[model samples]
Target: MVVRDAKPDEQTVTSLAAAAGTAPSMFNAQPWRFRYLRDAATFQLRAALDRTLPHTDPHGRALHLGCGAALFNLRVAAAHAGWEPVVTLLPDPYDPRLLATVRLAPADAPDQELARLHPTLTRRHSSRVPFRDELVPEPVRARLRAAAEREGGQLHFPSIWHVRAILELVRDAEGRDRATPARAEERERWTRTPEEARTATDGVVEQVLGPYGGYHSIPVRDLAGRHSAFEQGDPTPFEEEPQLALLGTAEDRPADWLRAGQAMERVLLLCTEYGLSTGLTTQVLEWSELRWPVRDPESGMGQVQMVIRLGYGPPVPGSPRRPVGQILEID
Candidate 1:
């Protein structure tokens, strides 16, 4: 068996880090850090606790999900660059914040499946605008389900009744947020002002918030709280049946959350490659009491990691990312 060299070049590391940095996170918080071990040829993903959304993501499950997505991107980037990535989730139990370690080694054959997704990494952004009522073709839906399954998770398109329950739970969570000043304050920390949005490297910007969903029926999360500058658009009814999917796993541990995150990104990238716009709502799942009913009662899906909306719609602008240098530490 052949082993790869212990060190990768600076340019290679920088490129991979940049690609990994593109993965989506809660409220665009981008709560992750990468450290490349030159001697070991491994890239470590660590949680940036300072960036955590304490009130919204109290248990850090969302943060783990975001980091897991970043880890998958690193794998794709390495594959595209003609290397094989061997990833280990939660590599250090002693340090819970260390989410993953990916060893990039020279490969006899690059991972074509992963390399194929590299191009779509930057193209996939959360679209908060309304999606057309058109149905996502059955074949396309099958492909997305396969994408999640490939990463060891299940993606279920909930039945209409389940969808209604999920939506109502979201409404309840939103109502709770309205009553909880701390939750709103936590959200504001990651939401950029118009001026900040123009230059900030992180957080959800005002422009990308889309016009206020004039109707509460829309599934899009209102990032622009009461203080937003954008005026509400005309009150239009959202589609009676929006294309929604719940990404889940058999368990709800940190390792499971990490796997769920990778699955979520794989599904998102596949959707983007097929020209689908996506939005996410984890509001319901954020609350333990509301999370259980979101699951399909018959499917045996234990935990729902994310609530995703997919359809044909105008693309939303990409959020800013911290510089690669700032996110990557060489050791």
Candidate 2:
């Protein structure tokens, strides 16, 4: 119920789109596009189907999650820029690719909560390295859970047995990928070569791949697989009881995935603010057979969206992002 003024300037649109593009994606595919409707003062979010992983994400659920994360970043950027974002998810059913339309309206009072997170936006990066054994404190865990709840999602800390089971499933997934090389096509496509890693605008690179978990069994996804010649430096054992959390929604629909993505980013930002390093493991969740068992049997919250690992660890370099001009279109 908010009215828009004249079209937003090109600079403002570009800045917002650029900030939105910083959100993380599976394998750094960044499969999302933005279009600024000058006349309507709205920014449209659409899935970049060409950048999607057909083998791993056939139904485009992961793609939607990535786009939703970008949408959240857009909202935060708009608030930081002193504008209120009025969002409409799946705005047009006839156009399924159109994920959202955000109208930038003048705000009587800007959202301070969202604006405060701007500083942490660029600081948050996925750490593939080993995390210390130290546990995340109760107070910080409470805050993370609250952050997820605010975004219409639930974050659950799995039991020891559940963690072991999840790790086993992840190992199974890795073994399957090794055996079925065809399934790795999408992964290989998104992982850059050494030379390309240095200059490429998108995709995960060798430097961020971290040391291989030779003896230790941390649930970190091995982006390097068997192709990279990069040596594993200072192989140290990861934490024995690594802290893990499960992000889930009440429902398993596209809209719910969007909410889960927003929640995931919120929790991640909060964790970053608390000096916690984070990593994600979605290999088990990628397959339906292994995904069901990931949920906490007691909680009855079965729709798992992401598995988060958090601890104190070394800083990870931020991945490159596509230029704002490449992602944003003005109409």
Runs in model 1 deviating more than 4 A are 1-3, 226-233
* Residue pairs in candidate 2 whose N, alpha carbon or C atoms collide under 3 angstroms: none
Candidate 2 C-alpha lDDT tens digits along 1-331: 3444545688999999999998989999999999998878899999998898888887787888888889989989999988989998998889989999999988878799988888788999999888888888889999999999988999998888888888888888777766667667778889999989778999998878887776345688877774233465546577788789999999988889888888999898889888999988888888888889888887778599999999999888999889988899999
What is the C-alpha local distance difference test score of candidate 1? 0.87
Please give the TM-score that candidate 1 achieves against the real structure.
0.95
Best by lDDT: 1
Error of 1 at 22 (Å): 0.3
lDDT of each: 0.87, 0.86
Segments in model 2 whose C-alpha atoms lie over 4 Å from true places: 1-7, 227-235
In candidate 2 the C-alpha lDDT for residue 154 amounts to 95
